[model samples]
Target chain A: MTSPAGRRKHGRPTISDVAALAGVSAGAVSKVFNGTGRISPPTAERVREAARKLNWTPNPAAIALRTSRAQAIGLVLTSSSPVPEVGAANVGLISGIESLLSPREYGLLLNVFLTGHHDESAFYRSLAERQRMDGVILTNSVVGDTRFDLMRDLGVPAVLVGTPWKPGVVDYIDADPPSAGIPETVDHLVGLGHRDVAFVSGPAGFVLPNIRREAFTARLAHHGLTPHSVSSVGYSPAAAAEETSRLLDVAAPPTAILYGTDTMAIAGMRTIQSRGLRVPEDVSVVGFEGLEVGEWVDPQLTTVQRFAFQRGRAAAAKLLGLLGETIEEDVPLEKPVLIVRQSTAPPRSR
Target chain B: MTSPAGRRKHGRPTISDVAALAGVSAGAVSKVFNGTGRISPPTAERVREAARKLNWTPNPAAIALRTSRAQAIGLVLTSSSPVPEVGAANVGLISGIESLLSPREYGLLLNVFLTGHHDESAFYRSLAERQRMDGVILTNSVVGDTRFDLMRDLGVPAVLVGTPWKPGVVDYIDADPPSAGIPETVDHLVGLGHRDVAFVSGPAGFVLPNIRREAFTARLAHHGLTPHSVSSVGYSPAAAAEETSRLLDVAAPPTAILYGTDTMAIAGMRTIQSRGLRVPEDVSVVGFEGLEVGEWVDPQLTTVQRFAFQRGRAAAAKLLGLLGETIEEDVPLEKPVLIVRQSTAPPRSR
Candidate 1:
């Protein structure tokens, strides 16, 4: 039994061999293989099958010369605000994008940029300078995003994962931040007989928080019960815990607390437990982002199920759509359905 | 205020404009920008300054052509088994790899293979045929991964995220699976007065499980306890719950449960809680894979902490090393330190 490694004695088959077998020039073979330069499908199939048989591989450069397409999509995120845990989201997004790109034989090139940072500006400058990608997908968009302007100005077709301030200028898909969504979450809490509610807002000026805060305040007005308080904290779970602790310790504390993200929700739950306070029994909690970890957290959190994976898939489809591909415009954005678990219930005195 | 959307008032500045100011040939300007076909350092500096003055945005394709290096790294993962949660680890790994690749001006090209019960032979064939990448990195290597062999045969510089069966044939960086480190964890348990410890394994026959099973059994003997039982479960948190319930139903249930993964540990904790059992007091639970969620879980799971990020960094470093960049061989193994949190404690009256 000869090892496959040793048996490959002829060395890697090249395009020249395929050309010889097909009785064509190397350029013709490359054009056929790359499906460019006007080869019939049948003829291209024959060349491909012959190449497969001979183990002939096409040099990507030669293919690049024939097609003039990079055959790649670029994934962009802020380098400074590294979301390590949000990897699942990234993965889900990538998976969704891959589902779209793979069939078309398009590859994905992930590019990370540091926003408002000097060192990372060079990185962004470098990415814009290197025209190796067909389109770019920007996740983690912020107000006044220079990346959006830069990508557009460069004539690079791009899409945003989150809704941008100026919607029409660039294509975007976003989880409804606060206005239409958080009211439903707060309303659900109100339905559960919770009078006073507190909110944990992650990074005040961030799009989601700004939206959530306004929604919470407006919803409180509708209920004729003002929120106990709205607290600001860093994005870290630890920061959520400290903020949650402060909110919980105040006089006339709320019976329900809402969190901007799932990680914060989980922290709030633990903080509640540390005080011998039972979830839903003593206080209720609602979280956003619907993270997978939220399911396993004790008293499995009641959360608005934001479909990041679906959104990622939608973003990929939209980018492809910009490339003249078939796709639906109405990507699902039904308000995050609240997954009521052990986390929310009637107020203690109800 | 013109929306940056209007076609740029002026066309992108060209190398000619830069060359006219730098007083160098277009080729010299190109070579200088590409860091290839280089001019003298002073001349290169002059070209850069002049290009900056003209606000020259070198054509990406032209630069790519002049440099010749693709400035791309192909990251290949099996599309079929991609765990969405593992996206975080993938993110960490990519971020680590990107830290190196980005500095060197290399792009990360992600390839996911999802054939849906179809043979992956075509995927491999296409990859072998394509040469858009300077090198490739294969993550989450499974048993009988033919990629290593294919990469070796192609003579493309490559690195593996998980250890291959033939270790010396390819460079790889991976966590020393808990099986290899089980003795230490088990010893810690024994030292803490634990007996009748039950071992929960990940889906059997995996590389991590293969090592863990042996180490767990051997470690039990070393501690003078016959490792009587081993339970294997699927990788999901739900599987952990089911397995934990079964383990606890026994007439002589173990006093301690060692979970193979953090997800399993959380599941097992839920299982115990559902049975009206208290963790540590009823049956101590220890989990592997010290993710951030572990801290948020009540009883703040006492588990082995493997530096998933550091391991990612090390893998990137090894690839850099293989690329003839200087890196130390004494790359540290991120030991799994047992975080003695609220989850593990001595049995009451075992």
Candidate 2:
């Protein structure tokens, strides 16, 4: 079989072209490269000479089909990234996945999820069943999803970038949970003599919003304090500011506030200042997610930082292992730490 | 010419399958679809009958070759977008491009520009020279670039997302500049009764940083005032805050500042407030690019906004035209406006 000329015009010569030049079958050329069957010395010499003359190497995709046993894997990204937190992290995740796939000769296909479409899961099924990708990594997965079930039915290996809910037979790497730092956070705020603390979280669908809400309330209960929580938070700075304004205007306003994400925390702090209240003075502020922008402001944001890049590496490592590769050393992520910045201080003695 | 069954195992039926089933050439089957050639009406009936049985259409890539005579296009992305601010814009651009390609049956490949790579242009040249793509869209093109020159030399169709530097021959659509409201911006700042105004621009390689610097200086000159411009800038929040800090501490600190991007303006505002200064009370601030986060802050952000999605649509429209599609109604972006929020108020009298 002779491969098309256009694909080989400026790229490495194809096995078919080498076979054609050597007066042999394409399978013979492939076998010579794979070293599977014993060939007459003269035929092997002819194939080798033709490959050398063309500076030819086997196509990575073709090799992946034969050896790696998979052609491609996909990373599905939805259009709506509510919190402005995932851009850099997504880059890190993709780069890490590439690090594994490049060496194994597998291709990565990016499948973007768009709204106003019929069904997002259908896209994944088509990719795996029709396009025949080995498996896929789904980002921004929701609370109840059909995509996971579809992958399961198709027997395609799947990995979720966020926590898998009620997933008995699925593999996943959850987003850094604020649950891990609630204790330190509560201790620090209480040590500063705060009794009434309010919490602002992202939208119900995102960041497993309840994870932070439950953790914050439980931790507050543990401290024998009143829990004032705000759920209906968007990824916008305006949402946080609006909630902060309402919280401060209450008859019994809290002495401190905790935001589910760094962007929200920073915006909340700005809103507090705009209302003429001092951070940590009138209302101490805390953030989840270790965003770099948290440090760019004055009174650096006292936030619980999540290592996105390292988490990405972890996801890629997990996916590679599922692909049947012997596991190498895994990337070490700094345990979620309470990054104390200038934003937190004792409330005014009351 | 029936397509192999394995190739049709999962995908929707393809033209090759019809040929295989009908025991005819793929070209003969295509002729049945186009209503061309001098095949007997009975043979044509057989081809049509086979197609109906399988339910297949011609692949657009194959059709594009015979009809549009155009090759595929790629969009190159850089991995420096760490914040949510840039993510939305990038998505807008990609989706706009997708709007055009989906109907034409061309695939969009994303080529990420990684750091630590010695030659950026070599990547594009190799893609084109090796016949990987017919052309590519270079986002964030730098000054004195070799990519444009290489494309010109190779006779490849190219589109740029940003302004093409020294681009004498390349086809490009420059980003929507805040041309309609610069005078209003200047007037508002000057009306605030402040003479000392500073401009912090983006990197020298981007947005032709000199364009903003020179425009800002000349605009000040136009208002019969001297200009203080920071020409060396990185697309980072820390860099903006540091510059804002140095400017605020100067012997004759400016009463107002202009930032090249919204992220910078937001960071600068935070830095100013961190120093125990009020936003509009201490200094007025302005930003270019209409980022949604601007509305989420206290006092809101007084900045200019860009129509990234619409501009992307325009870029796609231009490339589609190059791909042999007739240009229709062009995407019209609303004129750039200088938004005046509470961040800009009359400077406190010295």
Candidate 3:
């Protein structure tokens, strides 16, 4: 009889070796290992014992090919900037998603493409065609996003990380209404005796920005005040500076300004101070997204905080459930809230 | 007499079908597609023609299994924070790496593990045993790092993103010296009449903080001046605040302070203001790692800037070259430079 070590010296043990040692057919051993084609507990134990003795483990690549499971999740981002923004919210989202996925031994395949430089549609098609991921988490949904139709046509499972433009189009995880804190923000500014308040929003056609802009408008209307001015700009520092300058240069410039994101608000604050005006004294600034950097800035920004990390975890969990993973418990998402800091105060008399 | 559509109605065409149509063996068809096991150009053309006609594309999973090429890169980050700092440098690094890999159709597998929460060694072992990635990019090298030996034992290819502690252990890409900007930083402060200069560095054992501190010490000695104080702390806002306070409470506080990172520097600025002292007036401040958020701070941070994005691209390119991929061109790495902003100025008379 060949010793186990002597057998291993020839080559790595195969399924047949385990089956031969266990006095079973290769089919039985395969079934026992794959948990497919029912077998008796005693026979399974015998096969397992033989395999453990032989020191053989199934190849993951072979298993993936046979089972048609990639055991990975896809996340593709599109950015206009050469270096995509690594904002606190984005980092929190990635960390939250990994928090759950890592335990399950699933990998996250991340890709970022510069807008207009790569054909995103082709990439999605290749991913589906190659079956590279079991499912994907989509973010930054735009109004009338055709990616929904593309995913559906490709028969790919997907979950959106932002507000869904069309209800029932797909499952989504977002800050419940995303405008939950808008009313509070408006109330705070209005209570501060500011009649002229303006909103600087993200570019049009994005679902989140559009939703936020409408929320700001409705909240102002509820207070019986009309917006002094509203402008939409790209989510870039340059754009933020230019728009803030335009707002400040206006005759009878607004006493307070609300920005779509904390990053934009921070830039606006810089622009305000560079022009020799003080925060809250000349123009009170409010921002959305309670990023940690907000506190580091002078006059800590007063903004609405969204729990991106929790949302990311929820989205991943929902995707896992769709992929037939047993979810231990449903993760709850927190609502956005208004965090008042030194950046906002009563506006000075014009 | 079956049409291509009629044949497709049965199932997706396989390599056998292409071989049969091209009057060649399956091995020939595979070799032609994989660019392995040399075949005549005309024979390859014939095989390609048959595959195109049948609309048969080899399954990527099957190819990966047979070729043992995962065609992916791994990046694992260890952070003490729940949500790791998503600083501009980190974001740029990821973006830069993806800029090169995405075009080559290689996926990036990114994992973040919280320190002490997960067994990082076990993770690396699994990554190697499972062949989940062809190579990995490692960052945040420390003194006497054992990971280098582990990678060697596991036969895993790796590229370090920071300075390698031991030379010839693995290929590395870092800001040349990382301390290249220190001399200029010291010069700027000394020129501004800052005699009592101190350096607040990242925690001990981190290679970067150690190198920067050594550079600071040597430069001060060159100027015939001694450091007022040198304290090592964790790279956290809380740590920065406490250390700054401790330094201030001393009998004779340093007139100028240089921090290991921009985040810590920003926090120090806030601490200085909270104590009723103004920046660059009572005490001048400087920081390393010129993060974009630095510009958004009250007195825009003056610090040394490292091009993390470019380094990321260089690291990825090097890893690809190690994995036997044809690197088109070498990506040039930029040295660190001191960016003078509003934070640094002549100190006030004691």
Superior by DockQ: candidate 1 or candidate 2: 1
lDDT of candidate 1 over B121-223, digit per residue (tens): 5454454455556677876555566767777766677888766755576788776653445787798788878878888887664566667777888888987
C-alpha positional error of residue B109 in candidate 3 after TM-score superposition, expressed in Å: 1.1
- Residue B317 shift from truth in candidate 2, angstroms: 4.6
TM-score of 3: 0.87
Q: What lDDT does the true structure give each of the candidates?
A: 0.71, 0.66, 0.81
lDDT of 3 by residue, B1-350 (tens): 25545667898987888888898999998876554466776887788778767868777667666777666788877676765434446777887788788876677888776666655665676566456678898988888988888788667899999888878887898876767888899999999999999898898999888888899999999999988888899877779889999989999898999998888898898899899999978888998887788887878899988877788899999998898877786698888899999999998887
| Chain A accuracy as TM-score for every candidate | 0.82, 0.77, 0.87
Ranking of predictions according to lDDT: 3, 1, 2
For candidate 1, give the DockQ: 0.38
TM-score of each: 0.83, 0.68, 0.87
**What lDDT tens digits, residue by residue, belong to model 2 across residues B45-81?**
6776676567564543344334333234667766454
- B162 Cα displacement, candidate 1 (Å): 2.9
Best by lDDT: 3
